[model samples]
Target: MTSAVTTDNSARPGYGQLLRTPGALGFVLPGFAARLPFGMLTISILLLVQHTTGSYGSAGIVAAVTGISMALSAPLMGILTDRFGQSAVLVPVVLAHAAAVGGLAALALADANVWFLALAAVPTGASVPQVGPMVRARWAARLEGSPLLPTAAAFESVTDEFTFVVGPVLATALCTGVHPAAGLVTEATLTLLGGLLFAARRASQPRTHAPSATGESRSFALSHPGLQVLILAFLGIGAVFGGMQVSLAAFSAEIGNPGANGLLYGVFAAGNMIAGIAMGAVAWKIGPRRRLILGYVGLTAAASVLWAANSVILLGALGLVVGLFIAPALITGYTMVEQLVPANARTEAFTWLTGSIAFGQAVAVILAGRLTDAHGSAYGFLVPMAATALALAVLLALRAKLAPKAPSRIVNASVSAPVSAAAPVSTSAGASAPGSEAAAGPRDRVNERGMGHRVPVTVD
Candidate 1:
C-alpha cells in the first residue's frame, strides 16, 4: 500500500509537461512573482540600511533581524492558512507586508535611527506570506499519486533558483542605478500584486475539511521522527549554501573583480537549475534517502575543492558542481516531508522546512563573514565544507529515522482515504476516518475548532 501510494504513476514526464496540468501555470507564475521579493528583500534592506547609517555592521544587523523574524513567523502563518482559507489569511498578510516595506523605505530616506530601521524590519519579515509552502502543498494535493509530482517539485526548485539568481542582480541595479528606495518599493509592489493574483485563484487552493478525530494529534510538526531529521538536513544544506555565498563574494573581491560576484553566483545557480530540470524529466527508482545521502557527499566534495583554486574561473566551475547537487537534495527532502506528515500539517511542515534553511543561511552568513575577515577569503570555504560534512554525518547516523512509515500506519490511518487528484486534501484536524467518511459522502466535513462536540483523534 505504501509503495503504491508513494510510487504511483511511474512514467516520467518532461519538465515542461507539468505545466500542462490544470491550474499549474496560474500557481507557478504568480508564485514566482510573489517570491521575487523573497530573493530581493534582504539585500535591499542591507543596502538601504548601509546607505542610511553609513555602517556595514549596522546594515548586517538589520538584515539579520529581518531574516530571523521571517524564519520564526513562517510556520505560524502556515498553520493559520491551513485553518482559515488561503484568501482569508493571505490578503491581510500581504497588505501588512507592503505597509512594512513602505515604512522601512520612508525611514531610510529620512535617515532615521538604525534601531528604528531594525524595528521596522521585524514586521516586514514576519508579514512575508509562506507562498512557497502553500504552492507546493497545492501541487501535491492537485497531483496526488502522479509521477509528475517530482517534476513539479523540481520545477519549483528551479523557479526558486531563478528568483534568487536574478533577484540580487535586479535589487543591486535598482538601488545603485535608480534610487535606494526604488528596490524596496518595487519589491513591495510585486509582492502585493503577485500575492493577490495567487489568492484569487480559488480552484488551486487545498481543501481542509473538519477532522473526525483530533485530541490525539500533535499540533507541532517536529513531533514526528521523519520530519525531525529532514528539517535538520535542510538546515545544514542551507548553511553550506549561505557560507558559500559569502565566501564567493569575498573571493571575487580579492581577485580584483567584485563585479563578477553576481556572475559567479549565477554560474552556480545555473548548474542547480539545469540539473533540477534534467532530474525532473527522468524516472527515479531510488528513494529520497539515498538521493539525499548522495547529494550531501557530492556537495561536500565540491565545496572542499574550492580552497585549492585561486582563479575565479576555477571557483566558478567548482561552484557549479556544488550547485548540481542542491536541487536533488531539496526535491527529495521536500517530497519526504510531504509523505511523513498528515495533509492538515503540510503547510506548517513545509514552512518549517523553508524556515530551517533560512535560519541556516542567516547563521552561515554571519559566521562566514567573520571567518573571511579574520583568516583571509580562502578560509571561508571551510565553512561550507564543515557544514556539508556535518549534514552528511547526521543523515547517515539517522538514516533509519528517515525511512517513512507505511501509509496504512500513519497516525491518522483511518482518515487517509484516497481522493480524486483534482480535489484538495482535507487538512482539518477533526476530519472523519477515511473509510467511514467516504461511505458517508464524497464531500468532506471539516469541523471548526469551536464546534460543540469533543474532537476525536484519528490513528493508524
Candidate 2:
C-alpha cells in the first residue's frame, strides 16, 4: 500500500492556492519552524569560526568537518526514526546536538586553543541534519495525494530559502552586534525549544502499531539501483551548490563586498522559492527522469550565468533564475526515491539522499576552497557545472529503465508499458496512494540488506 495523503479541506483553493486546510497550515508551520534552527546553524558555523578563529582556512575546515558529521549522522538517525518513530530517536540526538553546540560555544568564545576549537567541532557539526527534509517527509506521508503537498512543498522551499538566505544574515548581524554572542545562543535556544516542541507533538508521529511488514525488513541503500542513481545525482547537485557556497563567499570578499554574499544567496533561494510555489498549484505529471534531466540542464545554464557574469548583481539575478529548478528537482528526486525503494527503509533512503548532498558539499568545500585560493573564485565554478552536464546526460540515457515514463510523455512519444490515467498506481506494482479506497493490507516482502534480522527498509 502507498502512503496516505493529508487533505486540508478548509478552503477550496484555486490557482496559486497554498495552505488549503487548517491541517496543512498546522503541518507547514512546524515544518517551517523546525527548519529555522538547522538553517541558522549551517551558516552560523561559518560565521562563528570566522569571528572566533580569525582565519578563513580554519573556517572552511570547520565547515567541511560539519558537513562530514552531518552526512554521517543523517541516514542512521533517519533509519532509527523510521523504525522507532521520530520522537523516540530524534529527541535524544537533538539534545546531544544542543549540548554540543552550546558547550562548544563556550569553548569557541573563550579563545580555546585552535586544537580545542577544532576538536569541539565534531559533535557540534554532527548535530543538525536537514530537519526540514524529515519534517517534509512527515508532511509527505501526512499530506500525500492532496494538492496541498505540492503547495506545502512550495512553501517549504520558500522557507528553506529564507532560512539559508536570512539565517546567515541574522546570525552575522547578531554576532557582530552589541552582544556578539547572540548568534550561537539564539541557534542553541531554538534547537532546544523547537526540537522539544516537535518531539512533544502527537501528530508528528506516524500512525502505526507496528512496522509495516515491509518497513520491518532492512537493506543497504547502495544495492538498490534507483537509489544508486539518485545518490549519484545528489552528489553532483551537492557539489555544484557546495562550490557556490565557498566560491560566493570568497568571490564577494575578493570584490571588497563580502557582506553581499548572503544577499546573493538569498536571491538564489528567492528564485527557487517563488518558482516552487508557482509550480505547486499545477499538475506536474512529468516522468521523474525527464524532469531530472530538465533540472540538471537548468542548473548547468544557471552556472553558466555565474561563470559569465560581469557583476554581483548579474550573478545574483542569474542565481535567482537558476534557483527555480532546485526545489522541483529535489522534490521530484525524493518522490522517485520513494517509489523505487520499498515500504521500509524509506527513512534511510531519504537520509542517503540528503547525505549525498552533504558529502558533495563537503567535497566542494575542500576542493573549491583550494581552487579559489589558487585561482580566482570565478574559476571555481567550472568543475561543478561540467559535472552537472555529465550527470544529466547519464540520467537521460538511463531514463526509460530506472524511472517510469510519465503518462504524458508516453502519449507524445511512442512507448509500451505505460501507466494509464485510470490505472491504480501502486507504490510497487499494486500499491495505491494513501487515503485511497484501493489500498488494502500489505503483503510483506523480503528486504535483503547487502543481504538480516530486524532490518526494515521502506522505499520512501
| CA shift of 261, model 1, Å | 0.6
Worst 10 residues of 2 by lDDT: 443-452
lDDT of 2 by residue, 1-460 (tens): 1111112222333333545443555545665666677666656766777788888788777767878888888887777766677777668877888788887778878977666766787788677744665666665565433334445555666676677776777787787774546787888877777777776665745542244666655555456787778877888778877878887877898889878887887777778777766655655544446666788788777776577665898888877777887777766677665446543565677788888888887888788889888998877776577667766776777665465322222122111222223333343433346653234321111111110111222221
Off by over 4 Å in 1: 1-11, 209-219, 409-460
| Alpha-carbon local distance difference test for all models | 0.76, 0.65
My TM-score estimates for the predictions, one after another, are 0.85, 0.80
Top model number, lDDT: 1
RMSD of candidate 1 to the truth, in angstroms, is: 8.3
